[model samples]
Target: MSKLDPKLAERLRSNADGLFCAVAQQRGTGEVLMVAWMDGEALYRTLTTRKATYYSRSRQSYWVKGETSGNTQYVHEVRLDCDGDTVLLIVDQKGVACHTGTRTCFDTDILLSDSVE
Candidate 1:
């Protein structure tokens, strides 16, 4: 049902729900913004439209980043991992990337780190 190119679709390795990981990072800063999931249709939309489109697992629907919030992610490039299980989206982010209004989703949590020594 996806309108994705057959060749590109064939390379993807999705999970049981037919979704793959999508990581968004700031284009020039190289800062990781957020992580999401995407189906073939979402990927197709992102590629064609240059917008960050993701499949929401809890909502059971698709969402385009910045569609609701004014915080937008204008995608500059997309790269699929060699294993095709994950994708990296380079983007120019406007405003905060986290739903919590932080610049990035990872900003709040710091699990563990080695001593600086």
Candidate 2:
């Protein structure tokens, strides 16, 4: 993300609502761990650190997940959607990925879809 190409910069700026959604999933388990938004800085930080980081719209700042909770998401890969407005992260997850101590943020999907993982 070091100085995005002109086309990519335009794309990142165009439809972003000033923020792009980032979804993290466990690669082997196929468990969707969490979904958060990333600004340019957050996106760059994640790529550089190989850790999941996001922008908190409500708090209006950067948030590196697991900084305190120890539920760190070690990013394996990051994919930008065709639209370049969303991102998917394949991660090595540890412990819970949710604030509620659940394995995934979308744990409710277990009851609804029967294939949450």
RMSD of each: 1.0, 3.7
Least well predicted 10-residue stretch by lDDT in candidate 1 = 107-116
The lowest-lDDT stretch of 10 consecutive residues in candidate 2 is: 1-10
On residues 1-117, what C-alpha lDDT tens digit does candidate 1 reach at each position? 899999999999999999999999998899999999999999999999999999999999999999999888999999999999999999999999999989999998898989799
Question: Per-residue lDDT tens digits of candidate 2, residues 1-117?
Answer: 444345555667434368888999998989888899987778788888999989888899888889989989898998988987889999998889999888888765545545656
The alpha-carbon lDDT assigned to residue 113 of candidate 2 equals 43
Q: Model-by-model lDDT, in order? A: 0.96, 0.83
Please give the distance, in angstroms, between residue 71's alpha carbon in candidate 2 and its true position after superposition: 0.6
Relative to the unseen true structure, what is the C-alpha lDDT of residue 103 in candidate 1, on a scale of 0 to 100?
98
**What residue pairs are clashing in model 2?**
none
Candidate 1, residue 57: the lDDT equals: 100
Model 2 / residue 85 / CA error / Å: 0.7
Residue 68 displacement (Å), model 1: 0.8
For all predicted structures, in order, the TM-scores are: 0.96, 0.83
